[model samples]
Target: MRDDGRAILTPPARGIAHILPRDHPQRLVLNDEVHARPSEILEAPLKLSYLAVFAEGEQRADVWRRVQELAGRYGVDPAPDTANHYSANFGPFRIKCERHTEFLRLVFIVEDGRQPESFEEPALQAVPPEWLAALPGQLITAANVLLQHSDGDWPEPERIATQFFDGNALVGASIADGAAFAFTDFRIRADGFSRLLVMDHGMTPRQAGRTVQRLLEIDTYRILALLALPMAHVLAPFLAARERELAEVTRLLVEAKAPDEALLFDRLTRLEAEMESEQSRNHYRFSASVAYEALVDSRITELREERLAGLQTFREFLERRFLPAMETCRSSAASQESLSQRLTRVTQLLSTRVDITREAQTQDVLASMDRRAKLQLRLQETVEGLSIAAITYYIVGLVGYLAKGGSRAGLPIEVDLVMAASIPFVLVLTALALRHHRRKAARES
Candidate 1:
């Protein structure tokens, strides 16, 4: 059992092992996650450098491959690819690589018994430049950190800023409950690197290391969070134009006919695709920025910073500049989400209208078919009546010829009367027979 009342992870007691459930596939990994990327114990009078490489997309494997190659040259054992962090001793300087979601953090530490002039002799001076050049991904953040022991008195922020930061305004504070003091201008100098100066005052190596790590983390996360700002600026006008287009589409859809609705639906579908494409491009970046910003805030809080004289503190500096930019990113992302929802609603409404239009057209066609069928039936009935009359006239003419033949043979005189009597009978019989045949055909049909 551990001091925190949690049982230490180990094999179950021998007697109980047989009854215990099998371990989960990820048990060890999950248990050790909290211990990943631990801060290395650090001493004062140290030259430290941090590099954050923006490993965008699927670059983690490549980054690891390069790191492993570098390790081989230095005769250090390579870390497993699954490791979240790696550290090794390399003669003059020590290095640590920490893997994060979108960026890889490389920290170099060197013993600085004789602190050189500011960043002129940084920890990176010991690293192979060719190796660094070959490393994948672009550098997103870089900083030179100097940790010096406080002997007599604390240095003035303005003086330190002038000497190290080229007279730029500084922001820092006494941190770790006055165990140390930190100052930085947070400006990239001509050498393309920012600087942080820390003076340790009676701090244990662990506390000093934690303080430095937090400071670097704050710097890294702050910059990372601001990365979304540029995209937000570019997206603002696009969103406005899209909103206008959506409004126009809606207005045109109100009274659209069937063919017009089809055209409008096609247009709306294209617009929706554009919106989804934009969202796909920006969504992850925006969300990651928010997460990075939150990390920055959390690390700042953990620093336990106190005012160093009347100088601006790290929190104040970032709040003044960083937070507003982060908020703009959030607002832009929110606007995009809202706009996407609006587009979906409009598309759904358009689809429903199109469906209704198709249904109405189908109903109209069905009604027309019914009307045509009625007209055809009426015409057939008229034709049947004319056919029956024609048949009756022809049959009566034949009967008259037969009666005239009989009179000529002297079997029956009065041919006109006989033909006249046959007329009524023929007419009645023809009418009845035609009506019966029509009824039979109607039943069969």
Candidate 2:
């Protein structure tokens, strides 16, 4: 018997295998084939499933309405919102919806026992071949419904092309765009597990419901990739913008010139501070993404290699693009510095010219004062000479009168002779006396 409580096969020649010994249990041959042909023995039908996922956005109510309409169109019983009973039945398949933070999940599952003949039937029957043909159209319609409900304000379709593998086989490609994407797995061997992936974008409730539906049907990896890709797309722009901003700041740092060393240092420091923050954010987000990928898939070696390649490319871009830009900025900054220096020199020259003009004006003032002082001194000397002459005249006149009176009093000499002689003597004597008296008065005063 197998571990699953199923009967095991033994070789016909060996007869029935016995129970194992107490120590080894080697006698019991564990059957590896007990569950190998589950489809043949289980009597469950193979059916196709569909799921739609939603995220928290402006279109929550619309998504719910559309999903409900889809359920009605497909004659599927919609699941209630209870925690335990979240699945609905459509033909041979079960559809489930679940809610998550900011998103909704949907899951679909089909039984493996029997192949249904018709999806149109109310009960279990083989899924009609036409349903497979119709699935693509239905998925498209669902996307259209979502778009319409959103008033055509859906995110622009960003096509992401990727390859998926089933075990070792390169199965097929996946193209995710806008609010829809599909995955086809060619490696599925059984009808129940065969290729088919369709997802619809919606608000959080609808997305959760759709994710739950999908989780019940498809492999978990597909869901993870789907969810992660959109997130990565959103983050890519932010990351790129940060990279650009950092590059610009670095350029500014290299180009900055300080007329004063202190100012330059301050600018450079500020730029470096901002750059550090930008780089930190960039590295943290990128590394965190890499770590997340590592956790999602154990094949870290390839991811590491890719990361290294990306880093190398980034370095190359920095060297090729950023370096040149920085050089240009440096040149500009140098030009500015040269201009500033020239301006400073011109200002100094102007200041010197002004000082020279002021000095010339001061010299003119001093020269005028010196001339005035000399003129005043000469005037004082002339006044002194004139005063002496005036006193000499007055004394000479007094002498003439005295000589005339001497002639009248004495009878012996000629009056004219005496007057002439006496006048000369008197003039000399009077001049000396006046000079002495002026000197004495000047001393006393």
- Top lDDT hit: 1
Q: Candidate 1 clash total?
A: 0
What TM-score fits each model?
0.85, 0.28
Worst 10 residues of 2 by lDDT: 137-146
Root-mean-square deviation (CA) per prediction: 5.6, 25.6
True lDDT of residue 443, candidate 1? 100
Give the Å shift of residue 211 in candidate 1: 2.5
- Residue 112: error of model 1 in Å? 4.3
